[model samples]
Target: MIGGASAYDGTNCKAPGNCWEPKPGYPDKVAGSKYDPKHDPKEINKQSESIKAMEARNAQRVANFKKTGTFVYDVSKIPAAN
Candidate 1:
């Protein structure tokens, strides 16, 4: 009617030109590496670093709150811990 029959054909429709196709078992690959998902050491390290930074920031906020009865909403606003 409006667009065409392919528009209403759902997933069964075929593209006209060179269309992008998803790789098989793409979900199993997070970083697109052969040793991805199972052996993602780099990603794990990054997450651990992030967690450590968050923990340190929270500790700083808590110490600041204990000293002065105001909770810091932003980590950047928190004073440097000495």
Candidate 2:
């Protein structure tokens, strides 16, 4: 007979014919799927590009502020934090 609680992540299949085993404290249905970077390479590249662009913009803003001794800002305009 199959015995013991299964791993919560369901990445492990303990023994043979024990597929119906239950995991304690975590329901089997809500576990996230295993990560596969190969499945979404374009999305990953887009995110990477966006991060690089933001870093470059921030560095430029900091350099400009240091040189001019004044930071540009408008109280009425604020970028929403996504």
Candidate 3:
């Protein structure tokens, strides 16, 4: 059964040569720390722009497919059928 994100126990690193090491959690504890909003507006804007560009490209591809009944294929390399 699946549980919430924090339900599963993380790695145990009690002994030497173990991979796990304690790292500071999000909004890390520090002296005189000030809290800021988690989301970045600049990053969000960039992501939006990327999504719009992708949509435009996809529309263009669809239009091309409609114009040409034959679809593009890489005849040089064929995928293995399992």
- Per-candidate TM vs. native? 0.47, 0.43, 0.41
Q: Over the full model, what C-alpha lDDT does candidate 1 score relative to the true structure?
A: 0.73
Candidates by lDDT, descending order: 1, 2, 3
Q: What TM-score does candidate 2 get on C-alpha atoms? A: 0.43
lDDT tens digits, residue span 1-82, model 1 = 5676544323332466535444566553357666455766897799899999999888888989998899997978987767
lDDT of 3 by residue, 1-82 (tens): 6677654356665775565654656444443445444667898799889999878666655555566664434322322324
Cα miss at 69, model 3 (Å)?
Answer: 1.5
State how far residue 29 of model 1 sits from its true place (Å).
18
Ranking by TM-score: 1, 2, 3
Deviating ranges (above 4 Å) for candidate 3: 1-33, 38-40, 72-82
lDDT tens string, model 2, 1-82?
Answer: 6688754656455766566654566455554534323456787699889999878777666666676677745422333335
Name the best candidate (by lDDT).
1
Q: What is the lDDT of residue 71 in candidate 1?
A: 100
Model 1 residue 38 lDDT?
Answer: 77
Per-candidate Cα lDDT values, in order, are 0.73, 0.60, 0.58
